[model samples]
Target: MKNSIFFTALLATTISLASCHNSNAKPVISNEIASIEKTSVDGNTKIQVALLLDTSNSMDGLIEQAKSRLWNIVNTLTTLKYNGKTPDIEISLYEYGNDGLSAEANYIRQVTPLTTDLDLISEKLFTLRTNGGSEYCGAVIQDATKQLSWGKDNDNMKLIYVCGNEAFNQGGINYKEAISDALKNDIYVNTIFCGNQQDGINSYWKDGADYGKGKYFNIDSNRAIHYIVTPYDVQITTCNERINNTYINYGSHGYEKKQKQAEQDRNAGSVSSANYAERTVSKSKAAYKNDSWDLVDKMKDDEKAIDKLKKEELPEELKNKSKEEIKVFVAKKSKEREAIQKEISELAKKRQDYIDTEAKKTKTQDDLGNAISTSIVSLAKVKGYSVEK
Candidate 1:
């Protein structure tokens, strides 16, 4: 499901895999199109988040926090009630550092395009490694604005969060110009400086946030992340395993995607059982839809999905079955997945309650998760979004 150069593992999906390319090159495409199709069909607008993380040597801690807390952040988005319904979420990732990037381009890589596949996002976060390299705030921001489709309409809350620990005004590209580009497209460029607030201000990080009309946060990247293990964790993990059983693989990438799903599940478990449980809870949510690959998700997205796919394009398992049979099979799986998801959702609420109570006893510390959570809720409220009870 994920990292290098921690170690190398090949992946087919390009949602957020790591690689460096110039902004002038063709832009990478991911799940945005499918999301657009879904939106057009359902009239469900999306909240887009472009997360630009610096992967230079000293910022390893930030990557770790991202890996652990991404599912929690996904769950956070699910709570948003905008104009009487929750908006769809699409997240993109960019990693900038001289370690595995173009030095001439200021060490910037558009790691992933905007995607709704949360598993892919988790996969890419775990793959990141820190190396000794330069961080250019301006160049990376410009790359995102030029390469990403920020959408034409301003109805969606389009945002960019760039986290780094270096001077904001580094390299040839002027940060003022970069922030100006973001503002032009109505993209909020929030800066998360991985150090002291004063140091961030001194480096002009706050100025960048001001230019884009976004929140500015400074985090202690070295702080260890803490999770409260609740009695509901084991139940949630079991529910997660059961949920996986309901996925009906019926396309070329179906089997691979199914395996990758389990692999990411293991990846989360390897980090912490609590992280795994949190991810399981996320998988149960509405945002975990992966219609691009899985038949159940595809059918859910469009009722005519079976008719749309040619018989040759169907997976080997589905080839022998009648169209009617395949439809019935997918429908059964969808129902099963729904039941398991409901159970996980119920358990997750209890888990959150337990954690929320335990949270009162701990001291607050600056970290990637907290910074994003604080900023996302704050900005969403200002934009007419509500957190549903």
Candidate 2:
């Protein structure tokens, strides 16, 4: 039973890619209202997860595992529904214990705010690098708790996952106080200790979770991730290509964002065939929205979006086209994307079944991905969220 649970969590987070240099620290919440407003009215709920990772000298393996398993975790989140309504999902990221960060900031940096831009998340996650530094678990947790725009809705699943190998109470900020504040804001803090279970317990990692009313997991941060290639993987990749052709870039950064989508695809593919397929499956889900760049996704929210776009902002292919022509083009592509997504969705189900079967035969291995996602699924169930089996 335990192995099955671990395998499921591994499946949830096991697809990630790409990297860039770290950005300057911005403590402010990027888009609080905008993020909440993006939530579908029917559901009016959100799944907000904040990842606090220790990027110290010894955590190269931990970062690699996170990069490899991003999409799997995203796919897992998409399966959850509250009151039978699909909830909007947002993830925030934080890096702590890096010498590259400002010491005045307690060696902690908020990499990204809670937002629906999964591509941005992927891009930023890749930028993280390990450096020898202090690991202030309490300080990082406190920043994530106070800074991110967490929803007050009782239905929202607001969770903070802090992963590291250091002592949980090493920081100046009292972990107990930080956890108390998080609970007051209705956020559950889960801890992932990247070492022996007893070591973690002795170091107060378990205590951190207990105080915040969340799960505590111990994992081997350096474990190699195993991927199972499914028969449907090829079909999913083909579907992904078809779907990419359906997006029409518009706005100032449209073309750049479009290129990023493809770049991320390449990054995922570079990891492994299974990771590539996992990303394709994530793209097929409703949560993989790209309204900020893709015309087809934009038109869903704003019918007059074409009229609002300046010609200079339009992609080269659409620059010469009239509003009516563009509208027709977008509409056509939207339908094509819908059809392709449906096909991928169907194939993804079969692919997952294949993986589940294969996973049952192998001994489960613990890693950062499994430790984090296992708790996500369990907590989702407790919070009245149902997985779409």
Whole-model Cα lDDT per candidate? 0.79, 0.82
The residue-level lDDT of candidate 1 at 221 comes to 83
TM-scores, each model vs. reference: 0.89, 0.90
- Predicted candidate 1: what Cα RMSD to the true structure? 4.1
Error of 1 at 33 (Å): 12
Candidate 1, position 151, lDDT: 66
What C-alpha lDDT, on a 0 to 100 scale, does residue 16 get in candidate 2?
A: 18
TM-score of 1: 0.89
Report lDDT (Cα) of residue 357, candidate 2.
Answer: 95
lDDT (0-100) at residue 30 of candidate 2?
36
